[model samples]
Target: MKIKDYAILISVIMIIVMMVIPLPPLLLDILIMINLSIALTIILVAMNTREALEFSIFPTLLLLTTLFRLGLNVSTTRSILTNQTGGEVIETFGSFVVGGSAIIGILVFLILVIIQFLVITKGSERVAEVAARFTLDSMPGKQMSIDADLGAGMISDMEAKKRREKVSQEADFYGAMDGASKFVKGDAIAGIIITIINIIGGLLIGILVHGMPFGEAAQLFTLLSIGDGLVSQIPALLISTAAGIVVTRAVSEGNLGTDITKQLFAYPKLLYIVAGTLSLIAVFTPINPMLVLPVAGLVAYGGFTMQRNLNKEEKLEKEASAKSPELDSIKSPESVIDLLHVDAIEFEFGYGLIPIADKNQGGDLLDRVIMIRRQCAIELGIVVPVIRIRDNIQLQPNEYVIKIKGNRVASGEIMLNHYLAMSPGIDDDSIEGIPTIEPAFGMPALWVNEDMKEEAEMSGYAIIDPPSVVSTHLTEVIKRHAHELIGRQEVRALIENIRETSPAVVEELIPNQLAIGDVQKVLMKLLKEKVSIRNLLAILETLADFSSQTKDPDLLTEYVRQALSRQITLQYAQPNQALQVITAGASLEKKFAESVHRTEQGTYLSIDPETSQLIFQSISEQASQMQRTGIQPILLASPGTRMYMRQFIERFSPELPVLSYNELEPEIEIQSVGIVNISSGAVNMS
Candidate 1:
């Protein structure tokens, strides 16, 4: 240990020794002075701390100080009883401080005890108890808030960890203070008992053993006892006061002295009012004008000085505002680096739509956006990055745009005072409203006012308010671009999450069989096809099994899909319902297999443009027929051709799902509603 550590240990040992050992008067006086100095230093430190935790060691310090004072009291009592005098400090306090009157000295000692015991010690104990209870009760909420900030990317993992540690330290500090305040209370009682014993014991010993007169014994012993009490109780009062200050202190930017002066003198007008009131009292009452008038004049002058200073500060601030330091900052070379950082997701709206996001205006768009992120996390199984929301002056007043990595992915307009009403496959001419298209799905809709909202609902139209419209549009945009959002960082986060529960699987798969980037590719491919990676454990295990066979993400993803056949089947097919799909004919599958070109890098489809056009036309016809029949078009192909077919279909219809036969469950029946053939121009329905 360092010297300070050894010094603390030695000081504690000395306190323990003082209780049992006798000491000379000069040494006792020196200890008494040191006790008073320590008390002063503690109280000063308490006042200078910005928060209670800054003085976290105070509870232990309080206990030690209380023990030291009690030990001193014991030593002084032994000296006064044996030698008929305590020490120079005690005698000086009894004679000079209390005017050599035993009654006066006793009264001073009692008053100090009352202040320390009934006032400071009692209040400090109660405050500590309440603070500890409240701190413990608020711990969960503070932890959740920290987690929220961490999840929102407002703080890093290290910052969140530090905040959590601080919260725990605050709880422990208050709890210790609650118990330590009792030591101060007990010390007060002990001081009173020790002083009474000293006076009574000294009186008996002086008369019987030393042969002193009754009046003389009473006089000398009472003076010595009261003096010793005063010396000890005064330090006890200071230490108790420090305990109260530490417990009651709030977290602030400044210490107690600065906060007090800044807050107390915040309003100079209050000082002027008080000065006028004092002047009126001086004029009307029997109070001496000579005493009150000058005091009032001083107060009024202070107010004037404060007001002038405030006005000067306001002038300086206005001058600073006029200079436009922000423009100068933008011109600096360092500002260019700041512009390079693009948010992963940004939602920018025009000024008129601000009320939809501002809480004071009763807008819940921001809340809805948070829910959108959570919903995407549950459905897509990816950590959505923090969505930065701001206002853009260039857009139309009612318009908002959603951007992914600085590129606008989707845009929509909202009418604040209206609701969107989409027809239920039948338009009612009676429900008249402004025509618009639903931003989320491009369904035909109308912006109906409140009057027509009820009417449109009664007419079987789906009603959606402006907030829901924006939320839905934003959600769909996120889901559509989720693949682009999940990079190596997100993949690493996912791997870490999995490592928490299934460490063996994660350790075996990551960097052992495939790298994070390789895993990211597989997840992105799954997400692009609207597959949920929420079953991450299953996905990881599948990769761990097949990754050694092939390092290719595409082949590994195909193997993963086959492994998740039950999830894929349940995703698209209803229970006991035959899945209706457009089946690729033998000739089309052959064409896809033949078109697959293999390089050392990977395999890719290299079909001719003419054949691609014919294939696109054939698939479009089948999809249109399925749409007419109210069925979503899902193409079923062989496992070898499924990935190539998806790649080919993504160019014209990126939203389409092309599944392999192995991706479906064995229990489910497959119904081919249409057939795609290269030889034939159209799809043949089965």
Candidate 2:
């Protein structure tokens, strides 16, 4: 068995042995100190750890420590009554009161008991209970957030798994603490009871059994009893304080001591007020000047020192800024060359929304941009440029614009303080707010306050915050413009990245069969149709096989599509379900085949504009009909017409999925949803 497996059992058995055996005074003293050491170590660990989950073993350890301390108390009680001694440890602690008043030792013991039982234990127990309940209640939301990040491609599978495990561990830790808190509370009560028992039992044993005088018996046993209690209670007090800190601490970068000092010494203005109050007390109150004057002077001096440090820090910051290379370069903006280069993507927010755009003001737009870039890379297999975000004085307060290549592509307005509530199309409009349009999908929505969120949810409305609305719009915008972002540079980077894993594929395909530009065009063609180019090895291999036959990018793209049939079909068709599609009849297919025009540049559809309009109109009508019935709009045609039709219809319906019959796997069933038939009454094919 592993050491971890047996360690807990060994500790428990030792606790049992401690309660039963008659320990020697020397060994008893060692055990007592060890108990105090363990308790102190636990408290220190609690103070140092960054988060509660980092100390997940705390609850089980709490149980063991409490039992160990109790066992030591029992053995000491046994010694006190049995031989009128509890080792030198108890006698040493009792000496504190023996020099003067007996009442003083008893009062101090009682105070410690009251503080641990009534103050620390009670408060910590309540905190543990509340924390456990909240953690359990929020489990669903936390779990959902992890799954959403995974689904959005914002996080990889390994990251999502780790986050989910952390959520479960947090819930379990807090729940155990809720129950473990009872152990400390019981230990405190047991301490009080044990002290009383030791006192009464010690007196009886000393006077009746040992034949001592009543006064001497009382004095000797009372001191020993107080000392025994002190030893146990002090450790218990430390353990209880540690419990409080764990349940109450927020996740922070530093240890408890650093956090305390940093927060307390943050504001010198507050210190100035404190110093003034202390000076008033020193002058007006009956307090002695010796105690108050020097302390007040120290506080006044601390305030002055804090103010001086603050000024020095500000001065150093300005000096650092002045000395920065960027600042020096900005002295001649016209001469500097940075203004010539433009960002691939940029967001310009108006001045009123500055609070939400600044990272210091709780804005996580920068973080969201990173997630957006990751998601885009995962879904479309393209690297989106790092988006530049800045405040624009030219736009309205609530308005924002998204620019692609320094040209505006999309823009929207949002209310920073209110949430966007979109109807779920399941309930009547009972909740009232400012009606608006959702920018991502052009759906009708409402701007609702926080108070209305629950009601809106109850009414089946999708409530979204300003950041989310902007993120959704930005995601769609980037997805639509993904093709424009991928240039020869990005393609080269992809090839270099792939070379690390599959060098043979890159070596065989690039410069030998096709140049990097030729491969780039094929990748762009795939991206334009929303195909993920993440499978670059497969794409390169397919290009190598077919590039020898055709130097055309469009034909190479068709061959690549055939190679990616599984990826393409799985995305459009559900598993074990037939693929739904709109196909062209034989006559219409023949007409498109004959009209296909080829040049040294590329293939084109040479049909008259009038004939092309009629064919597209009929296809569009059929696609809309299928969409109304909730079927996805997919058109399958013969390989010859498929390429031409897609090239032909792309101008009108770029979002439509056009696939050749050969591009589908043989295993997938085909369900013909409609057939495109040009109206004979409207036009005739010559």
Candidate 3:
């Protein structure tokens, strides 16, 4: 373990020891929870970092406080009941009034929800990031090892501030504070509300069911006891949790996707509703109904306030609609059509320069091309490319070795032999008695010596050995096929070169960045053909070093190249290119546009029948595409574009379909895309 981890472990152990032994009962409850929390924090830090732990502290502290109070009540009441007259009665009374078991049960539930929140939100994000990063490593020049040592925790506000101070000289601290305030205040307030509601509900449940108004629940409900008491509360706990989820879904209405329980309780309405119901139950179940009556009133007050605020918002929206009708120019249907437009564009292949090291570089040319084509089709709107593989021979290291094990004959007789034994059938001019070769009846013939014929037949050996020239030719062909099938260094070098030059080139060469050898094909295409701005930027970086070495250019030219490289690098650096483009385009249009015009008169405030009809058609088309491919369409267009779009649809011979941006519905049933407010004027999109 690292020294830091060791220190934390030691400190937590010391704290746990103190908590178990000498601390007062009340303090012990607090210290025990704290100790447990510290242990948990350590595990989290080891697995993640400080940022993740910071989010857990609020819920932990609130739970500990509840447990501490529960313990105090139990100890004091048990001491009083010890002196009572009836032993069993006093014992029962003590259990109900003095024990703090209820709070402990509540604490467990809180911890579970906290864990769910972190895992759901952070866990999902971490998985996706790791996948993308892994996929990226296989691409050309961008390949680099990611250090796993980085903590999983988000950077702390204080740490973020410090980093920002170092990074931004002209940026204002207030801006940083504004952003931090949103999270801290929002999370803290939400935590407090949730804790209060949970503790109150549990307290009420304890009073009503266990007859413990100020003390612990009866013996049956003491912490960790395995009986009906624990089992029955499980359903109640789940119901509360479920209610919280439903309430949060209705109220929050956004991506609180991390912890369902935490988000559910984040809204004051859920907590208030749960507390009110539990408090009312306590009154009827024999506890002093008056004690819960006030609590119920408080919960009711909060609920009423929330309802009033929502009503006010609704009224304000109505008034605003009346005042400026033109504001609601975009409609739901037209927006969907705009989204489809984004999905239909396709990109063509653009290759970069290939690094060649040998004449056999052409062997893998098709495989390389196919890889790039598929990637471009996916990443740059190009279609899948066709790929083929071929084989070629390569020279081996042992080409010069030679050995001879036969006799040569001249004039139909053996001229020389390494070893020989005289035979009655073997003539002096025909040692081994073999005719070398002769054309007889238009066919070649081979003869063996009469004396060696028996030995050759016994061994079943070939009468004539094969020609070296034919054997050599077959060997060369086999070697060429094997080398070609495996791919050669030339192909590898070319791919590597392309990868180093342009990341886009690398992206284009592989399907999901899996083709490591297609980088060369990408480079070749980029250098040979015309391409888009994105591809051009990719090639600029790929060719920088080559250009610098081969051509003596002015400083201005080099500076331009450097600028272009930075731009492309920045583009690739964005987390999601498509989303980035949409947002960036929206911002630019918002700045440039003044007003949106409409077809009908009266300031054309909302989606009228004409716009609505057009938008309906657009949304219908988009809905169809969404069914085919599960991708949600994101519509981004200027107010002017929305208007022109509507007009274009009306006049076009093919009956062009377009969705309007102004008429988006609040719920998913009506609209899936939000209306990006770009200008002040009316542009009817529906």
Estimate the TM-score of every prediction: 0.77, 0.61, 0.22
Task: Give the alpha carbon lDDT tens digit for every residue of 116-153 in model 2.
Answer: 99999999999999999999999999998886666544
Ranking by TM-score: 1, 2, 3
Go through the candidates in order and give the clash count of each: 0, 0, 36
lDDT per residue for candidate 1 within 96-122, as digits (tens), equals: 999999999988889899988999999
Lowest lDDT block of 10, candidate 2: 677-686
| Pairs in steric clash, model 1 | none
- Note the Cα lDDT for every prediction shown: 0.91, 0.87, 0.34
Error of 2 at 609 (Å): 16
lDDT-wise, the better of 1 and 3 is: 1
**Model 1: runs farther than 4 Å from truth?**
1-38, 71-101, 122-183, 204-213, 216-221, 260-355, 358-361, 381-399, 423-436, 455-460, 486-523, 532-591, 610-641, 659-686
Candidate maximizing lDDT: 1
